[model samples]
Target: MSEQHSGRRRRPHYRALSPLREHLRESFWFAPLVACVGAVLLAGLTDLIDREIFAEATAEQTADTLLSFASAAKSVVSTVSSAMLTFIGVVFSISLVSLQMAAGQMSPRVLRLYVRSRLTKATFSTCLATFVFALLVQLGYDETTDPTRAVSVPIVSTVVALALVLLSLALFVLYVQATLRLLRVPHVIDRVTRESMQVLTAYRWLAPPPGQEAAERPEDPPDGPAPQGPVLLHEGRAGVLRDVNIRRLVRVARRHGTVLHLVPRIGDFIAPGTPTVLAAGGTAPRPRRIAFALNVGVDRTMHQDLSFGFRQLVDIAIRALSPAVNDPTTAVQAVDRIHQLLAVLAPLPVGELRHRDRDGAVRLVQSVPGWEATVDLAFTEIRICGAGQPQVTRRLTAALDDLLRITPQPRLPPLLTQRRLLERAVDAAVPDEHNRAFALAPDRQGIG
Candidate 1:
């Protein structure tokens, strides 16, 4: 019975200790290192106290002083330790008050209330009064024959010890300040706290549904008022999504089901009827693909500004990296296939979408390592192969010709303002097989 009762009490204390331990783990050195530093500081304090009582006076007078002082110190140890422990407690309470002041998390009324707290005000007052009374008595007991050497060593020791205490306290204050700032930062995303009640408390009081089985599903949104779906940034517009975008979609699908039935990633000529999402008994329509300069809303001068040109370049890049793969041997075949399909589907008003196949990577000239990482975004090394493979470097350079062609036009409408232009572009959008000829990764945005 006693053991069970003790265990129950310990469990609550352990829960309270957890966050403090976690905070210290992050803010200070490792636990063993802190312990060693604490031990050394304690030793230094002990030595200072010893020196203050025993370092000075003639050998004969010192002996007498030692006898009296040791007796007094021994007799006072229990009382002084208790009182010092109380002082330490007050220090913590005041330190907390100081923090509240620093953060502007306190006001004048709260400050007055804090001042009246037993630990904050009364304990400090008691310690202050005790120290003054002790000093007066200590002054009467200082029966020294020598003036200079009699006090110098003890004074120096006390000063050093006090300095070390102040240094430690300063270090702790700085640590707390830094930790508070770190906790305030936007990225941490944790709800750690020192209070056990805060920890054990539920976010909501509603009882969880019973049983090991999962909750039942609703087929669709309510008819009374449908909840808002995601707002599209570019509604009904078509442009090839990037490699990083595809993989992110696959990962999101995994939550709904272990197996996702989707078409090839990156550059698979996503046809008009191709579906991007069919999950949770819901379906999403295919995305339209467009080439900006060729599709619609082109200016008479056929010129574009830097920003619009940059957007077109990005679209070209998306088309470049995300092409349909067909195991082509020569660069010419790759380009011919891409040209034929795109010309039939998304007819370019100007030039054409192109492709090139190379045997090995032109950039960095190294194989991509096999390891994968979400945070690092590392993927398999892209290999360029085949004897007739074109120079990836030269082709990449040639790809810039389209950017040069899209000159600045005065009358082009903002894509935002010209909804009809986007609609027309989507209507004319075509899926080119350039994605198939190229080796690219999945999309991050989950757009097919």
Candidate 2:
């Protein structure tokens, strides 16, 4: 009984934590805000300490130190504070320009990578914190008062501000290097590919090992007398369905003795009033509970949406294939990365959308795209957009052939279909026989 009770207690805890984790993952300002608040508190404490210890010290008592050192501290902090403010403006301007270029040249979705970048946020926060700290220290220093009762110059605070200034400069240099790397086409594509592969690996369906006979698909739910009145839950807000907490949903379904069929997959847009789930066999869970399991956001994220990564790469590829850009080599690079990801995904189960409870009863059912849809998502757009470019056609042909060789026999049909489509596209686009043959061949870098 105790064990069962403990198990029941963990579900709500997990349900509460999932949204918090997602928010932190998508937000860039939280960390910087914390850092700035810490800086302000530290500055206040340091100022208090400086006033206590040196408030009564006379120049004669500290003659070993130059009086100019104390007098110049205020001037130095004031000048440094002004300089740091100017530096903040310059850094933000450069960052904005880079973001604009990236959005225009690549895809606007790639801007999220920049917005969530830790280096950019940290550098900006450090500069701002330094400016604030210096200002606080300068305000604490008053040189115009009578010499008999002059406010003590905060030596420690001033020295720390100097160190922060130097640190900000170092961070600025690193930020510049990071920004330059981000601007490079190859680097951006590689990063996007790497992230997509990660998402694939995380959510990939389990499959049998090589040389073993493939297992038969799981049997569908048993047909029985239908529930008299199934409850349909509608979405509360309209947004893209970014992720779902399946485990929590399964647990809730089991607890309520209901079977839940989720209507939308990750990356799907859900409108308010649309039926989001169909619950059979019991009263539907509270709407807020159902909604808690679903993460609906204004924009799609790479959280659990494997398609988002593919979308990013596809956007880049199509942009490159455009007449204005006219860069086939970059398109080829995107194709190569997509091929790698498809190979990773090909062996895995694509439509196994059932989630079972501890007793082995199916509790949650959701729709997922199968292997054919995934293949089309990855290749179809680039193939059509780059049909006129021989280099792109050749790379797509090679990618298809390579995928056919690497993926299991069960995944062969889609690869073959894609190959035939590529052939047809190349035939219709390229009139010259030589160029057509070259495009059809499995050449890695396309025709010379």
Best by lDDT: 2
The candidate maximizing TM-score is 2
Q: lDDT by residue for model 1 over 254-369, one digit each (tens)?
A: 33332222322222233334443222223322222111111121121001111121222222222233344222222322222222222221111111101111211110000111
Residue 73 lDDT (model 2): 80
Off by over 4 Å in 1: 1-56, 60-161, 186-448
What TM-score against the true fold does each predicted structure earn? Answer: 0.22, 0.86
Q: Go through the candidates in order and give each one's C-alpha lDDT.
A: 0.28, 0.77
Worst 10 contiguous positions by lDDT, candidate 2: 1-10
Clashes of each: 37, 0
Error of 2 at 291 (Å): 1.8
Write model 2 residue lDDT over 201-302, tens digit each, in one string. 643432222442234332222345533435556556889888888778888898889988887788898877767777877768876788877888899887
